[model samples]
Target: MALGWKLVVDAGDPHRQAAFWAEALGYQIEDNSTLIERLLAAGTVEQSLCVEFQGRLFWRDAAAVRHPDDPFDPVSGTGLGRRLLFNRVPEPKAGKNRLHVDVHADRGQRDATVARLRAHGATLVRHVKEPGGEWSVLTDPEGNEFCVS
Candidate 1:
C-alpha cells in the first residue's frame, strides 16, 4: 500500500498562508476548531497556542488546507488526504524553494487561473517557455514558489 503524506510549508503567518493557498487551489481550510475547543475544555492544550481567524479557531503556529473532496475526521476536522500544512517559523524565506508545487490549469484556462491567483496576492516571478511546455512561476504570499501551466 502507498503511504499517506501531506506537505508542510514554513511561513511567518500560518493563517494567512493557509487562506491564500485555500483560495488559490480552491481548497477548504481545515477547521480543527472542534478539536481545539475540546482540548481547551479538557485543559489538554493551552489557549495561548491558538488564535481565532475568520471566526474559526486555529493553532497559532500552524494551519492547513485540504482538497474539498477528501475524507476528514469530523471531530478533529483533519483531512485524510491531499493536505498542505503551513507552519509558523521565525526566519523569513531567503532563497528559492528546492521543492515546489505545480498547479495544472483546466484545459485552456491557464490565464484565468493565473490571474485569479495574482488577485489573491501571488506575485509573478517569471514566465517560462521551454521545449517541454510553457508555465508561469508565481510566489505565494509568503514567497513560496508554485507554477501554473
Candidate 2:
C-alpha cells in the first residue's frame, strides 16, 4: 500500500505564508471556520486557539492551502488531496532549506516568472546556469529558498 501526505512548512506567520503560497501556486486557502465555529459554540475549542483575519477565523498557529481542484471536506474545508500546511514556529529560519519547491515555467517564461515572484515579495538570491540549464534561486518573504526554472 501507498501512503498519502501533505507538505508542512514552519513559518513565523502561518497565515501570511499560506496566502503567499496560495497565490504562488494558484491554490485556495483552506477555510476551516465552519468547523471552528461549531466547535467554539459547543465549547469544544477555546477562543484562544483561533484568530480572525480579514474577518475569517483560522487556527491561531496554523494555516493551509490546497490545490483548487482537489477533493476536500466541505464542513471543515480540509483538503483530501495535495495540500501544504504552514505552522507557526518561534524561531526564524536558520539556514538553507533541506527541501525546496521548484516552480516550473514554460520554456521561455523563466525571466517573467522570476519578475512576477519578485513583485510578490520573493528575493532573488542568484541565477544559476549549469550544464543542465538555468534557474533563478529565490527566497520567499520569510526566507525559505525555492527555485524557478
Candidate 3:
C-alpha cells in the first residue's frame, strides 16, 4: 500500500517558520479553521492560543504548509498528504540540525534566490562547492538551516 508523509519541524514559532518555508518552497500554508473552531468550542484551547492566519483561524504555535497539488480534506482543512508541519518548542536551538531542506535554483538564479531569501529574514551562513555542485547554506529567521543549490 502507498503511504503518506509529512516533514515535521520543531521551532520556536511555527507560524513564522511556516510562512518563511512556504515562500521559500512555493507551497501553500494549510488552514485549520475547523480544528480551531472545535478546540475553541470545547475549551481545549484559549483564544490567545489561536491566530488569524491568512484571514482565517489557526493554532498559534503550529502550522502546516503543503504542495499545491497535494490531497487535503476541506471538511477539516487539513492536508492529507505531502506536507510540512512546523510545531513550537520551548528550548532554543543548541546544535546543528539533523535534517534540512535543499532548494534547487536554476543557473544564474542562485545568487538572486539567496538575496531574496535574505530579504525575507533569512541569513546567509556560507557557500559551498561540493563535488555535485555549488550551494549556499542559509538559516531562516529563527535559525533553522536550509540549503540552496
Candidate 4:
C-alpha cells in the first residue's frame, strides 16, 4: 500500500509564503477560487473563513504550491502529487528547522541559483564546504531553512 502526503510548513502569512515557494521551486500556486466561489454561492462555507487575494478567493489560513506538471483536481485545484501546503501560525519561526528541503542545481549553477533565490526573498545563512560537496544554507522569507547545491 502506498500512502500519500504533502509537505506542510507553518507560516505567518500563508499566501505570501506560497507565492515565494512557488517561484523558488518553479511550482504553481494552487488556485481554489472556483470551489470557493461555488461554496460561497451555495452558503456551504462562511465568507469570513476565506480571503480575497490578488482578486481570488483563498482559504484564510492556508495556501499551497504544487509542481507545475502534477495532476490536480479541476474543481478544487488541489494538487494530487508533490505539493507544499503553507498554513498560518500564530507565532513566528522560533528555532532551527528539524526538517528542510534541498534544492539541487546543475554543476556550476549553485551560485546563480542562490543569487536568484536571494532576489526572491531568501537570505543566505551560510555556505558549507565539505568533503562530500558544497551547499548554501538559506532562510526563506519566513525564516525556514533550506539548502541549495
Model 1 Cα lDDT, one tens digit per residue, 107-134:
8998899999999999999999999999
TM-score of each: 0.97, 0.95, 0.88, 0.96
Candidate 2 yields a Cα-based lDDT of 0.93
Worst lDDT 10-window in candidate 2: 17-26
Error of 3 at 107 (Å): 3.5
lDDT of 3 by residue, 1-149 (tens): 97778899998988888999889888889988887899899999899989886788988888999988988988777888778999989998888899999989887899999998999889999999989889999999988899999
Candidate 4 wrong stretches, greater than 4 Å:
none
- Write the residue-wise lDDT of candidate 4 on 46-138 in tens digits: 999999887899999999999999899999999999999999999999989999999987899999999999999999999999999899999
- Candidate 1, lDDT over the whole model: 0.95
Q: Give Cα-based local distance difference scores for all models.
A: 0.95, 0.93, 0.89, 0.95
Q: Supply every candidate's count of residue pairs whose N, Cα or C atoms clash at under 3 angstroms.
A: 0, 0, 0, 0
Q: In model 1, what is the error at residue 54, expressed in angstroms?
A: 0.4
Worst 10 residues of 4 by lDDT: 48-57
lDDT of 4 at 11: 97
Write down the RMSD of candidate 3 (Cα, Å). Answer: 2.0
